[model samples]
Target chain A: MSTWTSDAAALRSTWFLRGVRAAFSLPGLILVSSFIGFAALAKDAGVTMAQAAFMTGTVWALPSMVVLVGAIGSGAALPAAMFAVTLSAIRLMPMVMALAPEMRTGKTRQCVLYLLAHFVAVTSWVLAMERLKRVPPPMRTTYYAGLGGTLVTTNVIVVTVVYAVADALPSAVSAALLMLTPMYFLTSLWGSARERAGHVAMVLGLVLGPVFHIVLPQIDLLVAGLIGGTVAYGLQLWRRKVRAA
Target chain B: MFILVAGFAATDIWRFLGVYLGGKLSEDSDLLVLVRTMATALVAAVIGNLIVFPGGALAHTSLDLRIAAAALGFVGYLVSGKRMVVGIATAESLLLAGLYLNF
Candidate 1:
């Protein structure tokens, strides 16, 4: 009983609270507005409010939600819609890979990792990568939970509220609001670019991501991510060698 | 149910796989760096897709307005001690204001 009490305290320490506090800041706001936008967009695309909220809860990716809703509204085959949605989520693989390492601790069980991975979207993963170093390793998982939990909770509420009121807002307002998610990403991605390699990746992605989407809409994300990332990594390595020489 | 199962499963499977693979690597491993690089790049890709290939009301809005707002937001983040709220607010308001005036 004593050991159990200590473990609980350790997991819910100052770091955990700090994580919650930090998340309640810009990251939480970003997620809330984005999910609200998603709900509105999903509804506009003929998805029911319940379905939009469910997608927001389950898929947790704005692009995938958009794709699924678009596919459904356009009367595409179900398999094709599912396939497109799945393709949009390939980016999460790298995000989860980056997030999983810092989240491991002796106190954390493997089974818990599955639950945590569900919340490993772009906003949470980027903030975690940037801030996890400040946290002690043993408490990292709890800190992550605090942060990821806040965003998810806020998203659920935002999606629900926005879906409920989507029709009342003018199409212009709803349209602009929907852009908030992408706009947040634009700023957050540029703001969070810590290294030259990351910046190069951003520029390349800005070009390649859009171009690929136009050329090959089905697998644009997968193709752009692999090629753009590889080039950024290679360029950074070459620059370092040049500096050395 | 099919959409729920296939859509959720298709994405969730990668998350499961990522946790398994990432747990094996030590912090100092070089492969971890590559993964981080890939993740960052993927984030950039998603952002780009959002800007250029958006599928909803945002898709109809002019690209210049969105780009302008994003520019200001990035600038706001830098100017406001990297405060993400200030940046996003500035950008979002700009986007709304732009839309209101033009449309």
Candidate 2:
């Protein structure tokens, strides 16, 4: 009956404490800023508390949260908003795939993976990928749960607090806060696009996305990503082959 | 509710799928590379929309100012050794200042 009771208790106490402490450092600060920026953006988009709360809690990826607001505020269809948000999340797929191997051990196909997957946003993935190495392999998931849990809770609280107070603030102040969303995405992305292909993809998308939007306002983002991403991937393969030869 | 079912749920599907698949495949595989590339492109597309065809308050701002802010952000990011907050703050301050001065 108590096969893993001690593990669970230790996880919630020591591992969880370690995770929380790590969170309050760099990762926590970055996440707070990004979410604060996003909360402001959500307010400017006229997103309600319920909507923002849902996005913060579930769509925890700051980029996706920001993009959903942008897509919806532009009067895009429900499907379109979902599409953009989904696209923003594709980045996390590769991330979790890379990181999950470290979190689980043995042939355990526990349902814990599905729960952990929700915590695979940029900050958690990056920090956990690094900090999790310090932990025993068996305890990594618990460590991550603690870290990711704190971030999500903090973001939800920040979103609620920011949105609640936003209405009372002056329009200009709110607008400045709103502007922080793109600024955050652009700058943070600059750090992550560390490779040649990533830079190529980003440059192409930057050039092509707006053009596609101008031509076809509805599905521009999707089309641009397909084309630009394919081009970057192709280029990367070609470069690799050339180096091999 | 919509955000829950569609937005978060939709995104979670990918991560779940990834975990299932990652254990079996090599990261060097073409499929994974292509998917990662697509993700990068989509993010870039979002950035484009924000800088160029953005909705909300940014829509009211002029193109020149937006371009300048992005330029400032890029330089600031590079200068700050890729500190995200530094770069974002510089651009945000610039745009807000420009907006204020314009007003």
Top of the candidates by TM-score: 2
Error of 1 at A143 (Å): 6.2
What is the CAPRI rating of model 2's predicted complex? medium
Per-residue lDDT of model 1, residues A54-163, tens digit only: 77778776666666766676676777666656655665766677788777876779988889898887788878888887676777787888888877777877888888
Query: TM-score for each prediction?
Result: 0.75, 0.89
Give the CA lDDT, 0 to 100, for residue B19 in model 1: 86
DockQ of candidate 1 (2 decimals):
0.49
**Two-chain DockQ for model 2:** 0.61
The parts of candidate 2 lying over 4 Å away from their true place are: A1-12, A74-80, A107-109
- What is candidate 2's lDDT per residue for B1-103, written digit by digit as tens? 6677668777888888878877787776787678767778878787787788655566788888887888887798888888877777788888888898983
Which segments of model 1 are wrong by more than 4 Å? A1-24, A63-107, A123-150, A192-194, B2-6, B26-46, B53-60
Can you write out model 2's per-residue Cα lDDT over A78-186, one digit (the tens) per residue?
A: 8777877787788787787888888888853558877888888888887897887777767777788888888888889988898788768766566666666667667
Which residue pairs in model 1 clash with each other? none
For candidate 1, write residues B1-103 as lDDT tens digits.
6558656786788788888878564533545445445555655666776676666677777888887887788788889987778877887788888887884
